[model samples]
Structure formats: structure tokens, C-alpha cells
Target chain A: MSLNESLDALRAKMTSEAAGAYEEVLQRLDPRLLAENALKPGDVMPNFELPNAEGKMVSSLELLSHGTLVVTFYRGSWCPYCMLTLQALDLILAPVPGQQASLVALSPETGGRARFVKDKYNLRFELLADVDNAVASMFGVLVRLPPLYRQRLLSQGIESETLHGRKGWFIPVPSTFVVARNGTVAHAEIHVDYTRRTELDTLPLVLRALRQYS
Target chain B: MDLPQIGYFIVLSRVLNFTHAARECKITQPALSRAIKRLEWELGGDLLLRERSLTQLTEFGRAMLPLLEQVQAAADVARDEARQLQTQERAPLRLGLSPWLAFPLIGTVLREVIASVRSTEFSVSVEAEPVMRERMLRGDLDVLVGLRADTLPERFNQWQLFSTGAAVFLPRDHLLAADELIHGSRLAESVLLGASEPEALPERILSQIVRRLGRRPSTPHRASNWETSLQLVRSGLGLGLGLSCWPTPPELVARGLADRLPDYEVVVETIAGRPQSRAVSTFVKLARASAWMNPANVP
Candidate 1:
């Protein structure tokens, strides 16, 4: 199934209360941030080096140097939509002919969770520990979860210390950026309603244009 | 030196490119990256400063360069010496010390252990508690020193080492220095300098300080490590809380905290039920008998 279809299926399964809890978390964000675009085309993507699942430091510039870079910022492993997006990217993200592209996902979750999700999916790309959503905040995708919603999640057995290495209640807006060789953002997508995600099929076309940009 | 990380970093220091460095070392780029990351995690600072267009050694990296190179050279000499003697070359003992532990005890113990044990070598990593714990679980470390017995998992066999009271350092002329013990209220009034790089001061201590002061302490000048904290304090910036040990400087006075913070009952820990090699046992025995463990020496 397509990633959107799978996401819709997961959304269909959640009860009203669970769905409302997710919405309440997003509701805490500034209204303007939800309405605005982020990291527009031609803007220089900030440099970052974060530890991957194996605790390796993955650099944005190092990835970009290889060719186009596809960076996905997800909420955490607990979100099924993020999991589906990761699987789709791993399975369907074929490079355009004569193009070299590297994919990486970022989450504020700790290294252990990153490793768990990466191993479970058998993903090809690296899952980096953003560590307190510092990199996500830099990209303007970070949102602090409302304390009530945070408590709701904790009550459901998803403890903060286990997942995030601390009591950090912040999460990214679930973003995607296609970065070109020179570190310019070629395409940016920020989903306030995180159920919405980048279409994996469209990523190759963006990469094709990025290949031409360089 | 972590030989592989030392080798990878030495190559990268020359080439300054991940692809080139990995290629020269005949390893994947990610492996090289992980080695450097692990090395940085163990050392408690970033060895390389990676800006958008620039990659170079940081001040900490530069400071560590010659020392790491000397270790690499010494290892080379040891490797050849083992070959000439027709003896089996044993891997160096990978020892990890908690950043909160006093360093003097370990130094004396290691000195005696090396003198007695034939061909004994050591690669020590001194990092913050969580990092040390993670490394220990990953088998990156064989023996860990200075873990609280209560804090460790049941999988580790912990033995009592020594107990020490916590203290803070201030310039001798500071008004707070007049008291042998500094209270939380007086400390809250001044800017607090602390180590934040490898890891922040333990949450346990920070939370107690917060409770005692009834607010977060303002840190106008935070330090990356104790050395920088001393430098900042020496410049009349702020006082420092001891993470590991009291500063050796006579200009600074070390006052025990008069607040409700608990004493540390540090223990030596190793993987439970695992067969301890002769060298590890010898090292542990030497540690137990060390003069630093004497009751009078603590503090």
C-alpha cells in the first residue's frame, strides 16, 4: 500500500480519544508556525552532526557532498505514521538514473529507541538521535507537547526517560527537506498534522531536479 | 588510545575528509564516523570542529593530539616488543572511570598494577556516568570504577570502594570562602559555573540544588569542563562545584557543602558472573589495597 493509504488505515484504527490526544499535542504549537512555510528553496540548510542508531555522528554536509540529501524529521517510534514513512522510504526511495542520494531520519528519541526502530524495519538509511530536538528547533520544526498530552502518553506506558533519555516533551512537526550539493534547500515539507507526510514517489523527481541544480 | 579510533582520527587529521579517510583506512565511512564519535564520547569533548564548509581540530582536539599520538607510538613499540619476545600479545585493559570519582586513587593504583603485572597495558576512558554505563554495557569497557552501588543494575557485581563528601570551589577572597561550608542560599546568589560538555552535572545533584534554592541557579558563565571552570573562576567570574575532585590551586578554597546533598558511596563494578581475567583481578585487588582508599584521604 502507498504510505498515505497505510497512514489512513492507522488513523482509522485509533479511537476518538487517542486521535484527540495527538491533536492536543499539536495544538500547543504557535498558530502561525502551523500556517507558515519553512526552509524555502534556495535557503541554506544548517549544518548538523547527530549520532545515528549505532551512535555514529552523521553530518548533513557529509551526506550532501555525496549528492542530494533527503532528511526526514519524525516524532518518535511510537507514531505508526512515522514508522510507515520510514518503511516506505526504505522500500521505495529509488535514486534517479545517474544520481546519488542519501537519506537520514531525525527524532528526539534516545539512541536505544533509534536502534530499535532501525533494526525492526531493517532500514537502509540512518536514524539519528536529535537529542532534545535541538536540530529540529534549528529547522523550525520543533513543538513542545502540552503537559496534559505528555501525561496522557506517559500513562499509556510510553515513559519519557526510556524513549527520550530525559523528561523532554518536545517533538518535531515531521518534516522533509531535499538538500542539493551546495546545502541549499531544494524542497521543504512541514506537516503540522503529522499524519500527512511526503509522498515517497515524488522524492525521486525532486532528486532529479536537485541533480540538475548542481 | 582506542587504537582504531586513534588510527582513524590520525588519518582524518591528515586528509580532513570522511570519504578519503575511510578509504585510506579501508573501512566504511560510517565506521570511521562511529569510531570518532565513540572516541569523542569517551574523551568527553568534540575532537573535531565541523562547520558548514570547514572541518578542523577543536582546541580540545589539538590538546589531545600529541598525547594520543604518543600512545599510538608506544603501542607500536609494545607490539614489536611482544613479537621479538615470541610471546602472545594481550589486548590492553579497557578501563572506564566515572567522571565524579577522584582521580588520585586510580593513578596510584594503576602505577602499582603496571609495576607488578608483566606486560600490562591500559587504555582508560574517563567520562560522565551515563556514558560510562552505556560503554560498560556495550563491552567497550571491562571494569568501571566509582559507580554508586544503588544506581547500578543487578547485572554488575559492585564492591564498595570509598566514600567522599561533595564540595564547591571559590576564589579565596570571596565572602562565601570565609565559611568552611557554603549554604545553598549563598550559592544561589552567585553565578554557578559547571561542566556541560561530556555531560552536565548529575540530575540528582542539580535537582537537590534547585529544591534547596527554590529556583534554578543562574549561570552567567558555564564551563565545558573543570579546567575551563577554574579559568573562569580565576578571572573572578564565578565559583565551581566539584564534579570529580577539588582543584589543586591554592588560590581557590574548597568548601564542603552545608546543604542536604548526600554523600557518595562509590563502588567498583564489573559485569556479574563473567569470568574475570587474571589481569582484571590483579587490577581490582590493587585498587582495594591502595592507600587512597584510607578513610583519612577521602574529601
Candidate 2:
């Protein structure tokens, strides 16, 4: 199945299995507020250095020095939707190096969890651990999980502190940003609905446009 | 009185692009232009020389920039103080510290500050050097305790707290663990673990490595903080660099580098010439007086 199809299937199963929990989360999380606060196209992407799955430091400015940078912020490897998105991006990442662009995925998950995700998915690109969600917060993708949602996750044996190495129940809204070599955001897609994601096909078009401009 | 206009001017000066400045200020282009025009009218001087290709600050704009920054900073402080007062509370001094500094030293510094100012509270954050410096400049943090760097803005006043030499950390079973002194080039073949933040590693250590190897040492594994870096070294992923003052973990052995690198100085820094609240001033005084601030008292 396609990434979107798999994500949609998981979302459907989740909502049906726990309708009340889904409704409570939807009621508390205002998509409009998240969208407004999110970094958008034309914004200047902030410079940051984060540790990848193998614990290597990957820097945005240094990535741009090589070429354009494609950054994605996800919730965690445990999330099925995030896994689907990552797998899809992994396949798409095959051509990025040739296009003179580097792809990196960021999550609040600990280095161990990030390593798991990279190994499980056989990802070729960098999977960075945004410790304490510092970089995610800077990108305006970080949000505290609502109490009800936190309770639901906890009941399911998913303790955030164990997974993220931090006590706060916070996660980044799934976001994809294509930053040009000049540091301007060429394309940005922030999905309040965790299951939704930017299509892999659209990424190349954005990169091509940015390359043309450069 | 026109704080928004001053804000727009500041944004404009940094970006030097009207469209970008407007977007950053979340105002329409025409609105930003009008605000700047009004500001110029109020001051009776042109602030910018707008051209098709470039926007240059006028002589008056250059003269007024510092004053405007002061006004904005003062306004921010006043608003923050007033809000604290309304809540019947004193604003906790937001402090940012470098992650690689010895953790026990941080606890001691905090204890000193708290003991000196009984009523004051502190919210401490351990961040990378660049992030901490940025937060300090943005006024989000009141003080920064970290290694001194030449790259820091001239507006910050730094008080040297302590100085320590660099040490190399290796796994217990690593071949170099038996060495009393490890040569920089000897470890060139191993994956060097380091703090992810560039500034966390002292320049002298990197320079020594480069001078010995005829190239910059490649760090294959980098951790977000000192603890993680040390953990990587313990796991045998790579060697780690740390301050000699940091307590060596039971599983890791720290050896001094053969070539003497410069000592790293930990400093307490605050914005220069900025007005400080009573709580901030008290913290600064305590920091200055702390035993840690005395080089002679350094362990």
C-alpha cells in the first residue's frame, strides 16, 4: 500500500477501536492554531545541529553547504503513521543525493529509539534525535500532548519518558520542510492530522524549482 | 511609544529586506512601510535609503538603532517585571548553562546563588552553546554559565568562573585506556565521539588533533551532551573529550592528552549595560563571590 493508504488504514483502525479517545484529542487539539504557528514556505529556516541515530552530529548549515536540505519532524518511531511516512521518505531519499540535497528526519525519541527506527526501516538517510525537542520547538512543531491523549498512550504501555528519555509528554506535529541552499524555506508542509503527510512526488518538484532559482 | 514601529525597524535592520521584515513582523508590506514612515516622521529623520536592489540604513537610522534597541529591551523587562508583580511573585532568573560543564559544578553554582538570594528562584536550562548564547541575546535567558568563546557578542559581560584542562575518555577495555598520556594522533584511527554542539569542544583540542594528524579529526559519533558522549565512549563506540574536572564514570578511564592544550574557562555572562532587576543583580553578585569563580579555589 502507499504511505497515505497505510496511514489512513491505521488511523481508521485507531479511531474505531477508541472513538472516545480520538474525539477527546480532536476536541483539544486545534488544527488552526497549529497551522498558524507552524513555520511556512519563505520563512528562514533556523540553523541547528542535532545528533543522528548513530550519534553523528548533522548540521543544517553544513548540509546546505553541500546542497539544499530536506528536513522532516516526526512524532516517534513507535507511531505507525510516522513509520509509514519514514519508509516512504526512505525510498524517495535514494535520489536526493544525486540532486545535491540531503534528507534528515528529526524526532524527540532518544538516540536508542532513533537507532531502532533507522535499523528497522533500513533507512539510508540521517535520523536525528532532537533531544528535549529543542529543535522541534524552534520550528514551532512541538506541542504538549493533551492530558487525555497522554492517559490513553500511558494505558497502552507507551510511556513517553521511556521512549524519549524525558518526562514531558510532548511531540512534534509531522512537518516537512525543503530548505534552499540560500537558507530560505522553499517548501513547507505541516500536518495537524498525524496520519497525513506530504507526498514523496511533490518533494522533487520543489527541489527542482529551488534548483532553478539558484 | 510606538513599540511596534521600533520592532519593525529592528526586524528590518536584521533581515535588510522589507518583504522578509514584514513577514517576520506579521504585518503587510504596505503596513510596515507606513509604520517606518510614521517612525521617521515622529523622529524628523529618514531611517532607511530604499533602493531597487538594496536597503541601506541612513545616518540617522544608524544613530537611532542602539537607542531603539534599549527602548525595546527596557519595555520587555518592564512588561515581564510588571506581570511578575501582578502575580505577587518574583520572576525566576532564567539561566542557561553549557551541557558539557561538570554537572556537580552546576549544582554547586546553583546552591551558591540560591543561598545568597534566599527569596529568589531560578529556572535552569542545559543547552548547547549557540542556543544558550542566542537565548541570552533574545532576553529569554537572564544569564549564561558556559565556556568562554571569542565568537560571543561584545555586548555580553563575562566573569571567568573556573579553568580546567581537557581530558580524553576511553572505554575500560580500549587499548588506550592503559596509557597514562594519550597522543592525539594515536586515536586518529578510532571514531572520535564528541558533543554535537561545535562549541562544546575546545578549539585548542581540535587544533592539536589537526596539527598532529595533518587534518581535522573526524568524529563519527556525536552526542547531544557530555553525558551521552561519555556513554558512547563507555559503550566502545568511540573516544570522548571532556573537562578534567568532570567526574570520570566507573566504566571509563580519562587520560590527559600528551600535547598540552589550552585550559577551558567557564564563565558567567550577562548582557552589558542592561539594567538588571534586584534578583538578577543578586544572582550576579553571588556568582562573582562563589568559590568556583576563584581560579585558586578550582579543583
Candidate 3:
């Protein structure tokens, strides 16, 4: 099933009270400049180096050096939508090496949490911890959660600080960037609505086109 | 008036999915659909055959595809030219160099050239060779300093600067450190340290060695850059492959490879058949006259 359809199925199973809280959070979140101001195709992507789940440093140049790079940013592994997206990506990206491309997912979660998700999903790609969302901010995906929403999540036993090992209640709007080997963003998809994401199959097609064009 | 809409149409034609094409164009699916509809209205024909599961172009769309591609390419050239004009108004020279070049040599050459040429503001970008070539083609870069494995594209005019060889770097305490030249046969059992990216030059060189040896070495650690690769060698993790001219750290020893590796020529490249700006021409002139272009002068 498609990622959106899966998300819709999960949403249907949520209690009305939980559903209402999610709706309230989404309503309070302002997405006015989020998508428009985010990075776009033809823009130069900022180079970054972050620690992977195993604490080894991975850099943007290294990923791009292979071929086109697919960089996906998620709020954290705790988000079910993000997990579903990661699993979908893992399935589709199994043949990425054959396509001469690399995939790396970034999250504000700690290395431990990233490792947990990586092991749980049996992900073949590198999953890096963005630490304090510094890399996400560079991509213009960082957003501070509304106070009431943070309170609601905290009351539900979801503490961002404890999960991410950071004090800020910040998360990156789920986004994906297809960066060419030239370090230019060939495609960027920033979805302020967390339920949406770039389709998995489309990424390999973009990589193939980039190789052909270059 | 909506040239970008036409470009979007071209993208949609390729992807055959409104949602995918809209995401590529950074617009909503409805917006892209509306744009296509407006285009069809203006052209007086339906360009696409839409269905629940299948999206294909009609007869008119097939005929318009090549023409639209040419139009988009021409528009891009125009925009690139305008952007280049604006850039030159502020900085006379926007130079890009490849990271593989010996930094000290290029640094010295650039310093000498910039000092000799007065009132010419220079902005520099250090990037990979492919990126530099793309920027040069797009008119974003005035000149490029990089290596070419084969014949360059006809659009680029290139002048050979200097050539460099490759070497294998091993830890100081390694058994191979005592040898004057390291051979692929000797590295059969040793672990190789290389850049994580498969396309990196060092990794390519390592693969070449593996091919020659007929047996692959165990590569346990892959780094992101030359520095990291060297560090891995110094930390006794594995041996590394690097350019002969790169400065060696105190904890490692660099030796010539027994197998003759191909020599890469560092060259200065600019767009061919295009009128050169004063800054570009002057820099080229200085580069030709510079001692750094001669192999004998290089350390």
C-alpha cells in the first residue's frame, strides 16, 4: 500500500480524543512559509557532517561522491509516520547501490534511538543523528513545536528532550532532498503536514535521470 | 507568458504522474494540472490522455516535446547569461577549483595572480571536478582548475598545468613501510582504508589495485576524505591510497606503487568559443607563465 494510504489506515484506528489532539496540533501549526522558503531544486545544498547510529561521522560530500544522494529528514524515530516512511524507503532503496546512488536518513533523535530504529527496520542505509537539528535548520526544515502541543505530547509520556537528548522541543518538518553529485539540490520535498512524504519509487527515477543528464 | 509552465509540462510528460511532476516543480498537483489545462487551451489541443491508472501524451504532445525541450534549453541559456552578467558586475572573477589539486601549489599560484592583477575581485569555490564543469557550462564559473581523465567536452578549452602520480600510504610501524615500493601482491592480506564513497578517486585507485592483484583486500574502514583516510592509516586501522604530492603526516609513510598508475593532469579550463572576460584571460596568462605549471618546480 502507498504511504499515505497506510497513514490513513492508522489514523482511522486512533481514538477520537487522540485524533482531536492531532487535529488541534495540525491546526495550530502555521505552514505559511514552510514549504515556500524551504530549499528547492537548483539551489546549492549546504554540506554537513553528522554521526551515524554507530557514532561514525558521515558527510554530505561522501554521500554525493557515490552519485546522487537521497537525504531524508524526519522528526524522530518515535513518529509512526516516519517509521513507515523509513521502512518504505528501505524496501525501495535496496537496489540503490546498483543505481549508483546513496540514501541517508536524518533525525533529531539520539544515536541510540537511531540505532534502535535501524536495527528494528533492518535498514541497509545509513541513519544519522542530527543531534540538535543543526543540519535540519540548514535545510530550513527545523520547526519548534507549539507549547500546547508539546504539553499534550508530554502528558502522553512522549518527552522530546528525553528521546532526542536535547532541551529544545524542535523537530524538522519531514522533508527529502535529492542532491546531485554536483552538490545542487535536484529535488526537494518539504511537507509541513507530517502525514505526507515523497513517494519511494520516485527517488530512483530521479537518480536515473540525473545520471543520464549529467 | 508562463514559460515555467511549459517546463512543468515537459517534466509532467516525463514522469507521467501529476503528483510526482508537481513535487518536482515545487507546486501543488492541482496547480500543475491547471497549468497544463491552460497550456492546452492556449495551444488549442489536448496534450495529454488522462486515465485512472495510465497517463500518456496525445499525438500533439509527442510532436511538441522536442520543440518544448529546445525552448526550455534556450530559456535556461538566456537566464544563465543574465545571471553571469550580474555576477561579473560585482566580482570580476568567479573561479572554481577541484579538491584533488595540491592545495599549497594552487594557493601560491592564486595569490601571485591576484596580487599581479589590480582591481579584479576574485571569488572562489572549491568543488569536485564534475560540479566545476557544470558551473563552467552554466556560466556560473569563470575558470576551473581540475583533472580530466579523457578528452574534455568540445565546449571547454583546457590547458595542461602539471601531472601527479599516486602512492600508497602505510603506518610507520607497518611491515610494508620498510619496502621502497608497495605492490598489489603485498596488499592481498592487508586491510585497505579508503573513502566511503565508491566513486572517490582513492577508492577507484584501490579497486584498480584489487583488480591487478586478482584478490581483493579487506577494507574495514572507509573514511569521508583524504584527511580521514590518512588518520585511519595513522591509527593503525588500515593502509590508504593517496596522491603522491599530498603532504604526508608524521605517523605514516608514503611509497610509490609497484604497478604504474595513470598520471592525472591538472588543467585550467574555460568555456570554449566564448569571449573571455579580462579577469579570466589575465588569470590564464598568469597560469601559463607560472612556475607551478612545471613539474620540476613542484615539491
Candidate 4:
């Protein structure tokens, strides 16, 4: 099948699943939210109390109060692309002062599984576990993997048990953002897969934007 | 380097017609036409537009264009630095080679370079074009070898190795496995078990087969590599194509080919601004020498 047709089939499958969970989860959003960039510059970030890699509770407001924030969203730690991108960020942060923008990586994986990403990449940034994608849904970036990929990963012994010590089969699309000192998002980039990334050189431009906005 | 000439070449590579490229280049068609011929002669490759509608870049033309772009960018940077090449201390070379070439070619270059020059250390990372290109742009890698990359980002360089195309693999029990060779057109009717999902080389190979055979075969299974492709064939999914001369895969026998398909050219490339370290240069020299090592006939 063509790429579009395959994606359409996958979307139809997801629509059917959403119907079953319509009352509990799907109803929380306005139907038109998907077409919009949910978070914009100058918008206050929702004060979320998510757990970090070590299972300690960390509040978004606490991180913000310390310095500027660099909030990044990833599908999960299993992705090589995400691992590489995050590693690049980890390497560049020290050189770039960027007005003291502190870095934090958020993913759907929770608890010890979240810690694994930190340990694996030796990430100095905070790793937040956005369990069930509460934060990702708020940002309008959560989506289910197509069944083919879901089944493929499962058959390869990479089920959530291997990834997050659970059996869930959902993940968020990879995303990254530069939040200004006042908690407003200064820049954002979100892609469906790992191959595409916001280049590190692009970060300097974003930092300039934040400097102007702040 | 002339900016318009570079733009002309990029468009010419795509459309393959001087008139079309000139139309796109927005110059009188002849001026644009002359620019390309000049480019071909200036560089040693016959980057030609064959038949009125069809065009292909001769191996040399493809390799040199990216390097030319690098030279262009470096020239711009040097001008900014008072047009002095020696002003900037040469950056340590970061060479990127495909995993395949690193084993055979990169090792030899490393020893020669180390033996020759103890001062300069070449940092090398072995990865595929897709991954290596990403890192190369990030300034993490300086050069890459093997597999002609598609649409390298701005500021990257490419040097072409010859083209190497895909071939099929099958298990002994399968009917086609006993044959001396099988054409992709003939395999079109059969359920072809792919060794990988619908990604780069497989997609290109399968698309070519379907075009040649006039229909798409059912892809019952996909494996990530040659070994798995062989196993999937053995499992009765479909035939496979072993891309390399690696080991004989488990539970399958490779069939000989009477004829072969078109070859896909691979290349070595370096990111702009990163000069080759002594080691990387040595490696590139060795890789060019050994480009024909994979005969494309081994099972």
C-alpha cells in the first residue's frame, strides 16, 4: 500500500480504539485541538507534579523557579533516534549558556524505566515520567503507535516490560521546546519519528528569540 | 564559486534537461545549458542527461558536486576570516564510515596514519548514512564512507563509490533456490519475503521489481538484515536477497545468478568546515582502492 493509505488505515484503527475510551480519556479535549499548536509563546505552562527518573516527585513550578526551562518530549527511551538527539543536547548544554535554561526530558515511561534513559545517556538534565501521557496530552502530542509497529516491537521482546516494566503499548511523538524565564514557550518542534530533529544550530536562534521575549 | 551555477547544477541533476533546467534556472536556456557542460568538463565526471527526458549523474560528477559545495562554503568562510586558509588552525578530522567499511578499510587507514603522524588524532564513528549524516551535520562527524546518501543537508560533502544494487535470497527448499539465478521480474509473481520493513534499499528494490514486473508481490514478512531475510525465506515466507558476502546464513542455501540488476553507487563524504585528519585521509584513500571488493555475486 502507499504511505498515505497505510497511515489512513492506522488512523482508522486508532479512531476505533478512541471510541471505546471516549468517555474517560478522549472527551478531555476539544475535537479541534489536534490541528492547533496547543502551547504558544507567552502561555503559562501548567504547573504539573510529575515524577522524575528516580521516582521522586518534581514539580514544574520548582524547576521553573530555578532558571529558564528547556522541556523536551520523547516517545520513549527505546528509540535510537531519541537517544542520539538527547545525547546531543546533553553534550551542548554546557557550552550554551542560553540565559540559564535548564534542561528536562519528559517521556511516557515512569519510575525505574525512566531512570534508565538518564543512566543510559548520562543525561544531566532532569528526566520526567509523564505517565499515561498526561503532560503529552495537554501538549496535544500523544498518539498510539500503529499496530504493525506495536506488534513488531512486542515480537522483538521490547514490550513495555522491557521498556518501562509495564505492559502498556502506547507512546508519545518526539518533541522539544524552549521555555522562557517566565514559563512561556519560546520555541517548539515536534516530529512523528526520530530521523528528523531540530538541529543544535537551530537552538542558538531559539535562544535569541527567548532573549528578546524575556 | 558562482552561486547561480551551483543552483543550476542542483536543478539540472533533478530534471536532466538543459532546457528544463534553464527554465528552472530562469536564465536563457542556452546560458544554463552551457553552465552544465562547463561543470561536467571542469569536474572529471560525465554528469549527463541521457535521452531527451532521462538524466543520470556519472559517478565522478555525483562525488565532486558535494565536495565543490564544501569548497564554496569554505571559500565564503575564509573570505569572512579575511580570505586566509591558514588563519584557522585546521580542525581535527572526524571521519564517519559505514559499519561495513570501518571493519575492512578504516582499520588499515588508522594504523598507517598513526604510524605516520602521532600528533593528529582522527576521531571516527561508524554508522549508516542516515545516522551518520545526522551526526555529521551536528558537527559530531567529519566524513562518511559507503552508500551514496540521498539529499545531504547543506554544508555536507559526497564522494561516489560505484553503484551496488539489491539481489534476492532464497532457501534451498523453495523452488527458486535451486535455480542458477532469478530475475526480479520473474520474482514479482512470487511472495517475496523481505529481510526488512519498507525502508530505504528494500523500498527501492521492491519498487523497481514491481515496476519491471507490472505488479506488486505480497510481502508476507520483513527481516532487518541478510541473516533474518534468509531465515524468513527458510520459514516459507518468500525469497530473499543476501546483500553481502558475509557468512552462509543458517538453514538456507544461496542460489547463483545468471544475470544481475542495476547497481546502486555508494560514496564517502565529509561535513563542511571539518578538514580531514591524517587518519581520515588515509582511510578515504584505502576505501577508494577497495570499493570493488564486494563483487555483488557472493551469497
Score candidate 1 by TM-score against the native: 0.45
Model 1 ranges with Cα > 4 A deviation: A30-37, A94-98, A198-200, B1-96, B99-299
Taking the tens digit of each residue's C-alpha lDDT, what string does model 1 give over B1-299? 13556778888888878888999999998988887886665455688987766679989788767545534542343333323234434535678876555566567667655554456678888777667777878777878886474456657755454556666777889999899788888888888775574344433455578887899677666664456667778888877766435445778888888885876656666775454443454455445333233323321
* Residue pairs with clashing backbones, model 3: none
lDDT, residue B82, model 2:
31
lDDT of 2 by residue, B121-207 (tens): 778898887788888888888888888786778798665655688899887788888889988778677678755566566344666
**Could you report the Cα RMSD, in angstroms, for every candidate shown?**
20.7, 20.7, 22.8, 26.8
Off-target runs (Cα >4 Å) in candidate 3 are A198-200, B1-299
Candidate 2 lDDT tens digits, A101-179: 8899988765256667777778988888765565676576666566566777888888765555345466787889898
Can you write out model 4's per-residue Cα lDDT over A34-131, one digit (the tens) per residue?
A: 22435666666655545565434455666777666777888776665577677777766643544566788887663245566677667887877664
Candidate 4 chain A: minimum summed lDDT over ten consecutive residues — where? A22-31
TM-score of chain A of each: 0.90, 0.92, 0.92, 0.75
Candidate 1 chain B superposition, TM-score: 0.63
Which parts of model 4 have CA positions greater than 4 angstroms off?
A1-214, B1-128, B189-191, B195-197, B227-238, B242-260, B294-299
**Clashes (N, CA, C under 3 Å) per candidate:** 0, 1, 0, 13
**Candidate 2 chain B worst ten-residue window by lDDT:** B290-299
The native-contact fractions of the candidates, in order shown, are 0.00, 0.00, 0.00, 0.00
Model 4 chain B, poorest ten-residue lDDT window? B77-86
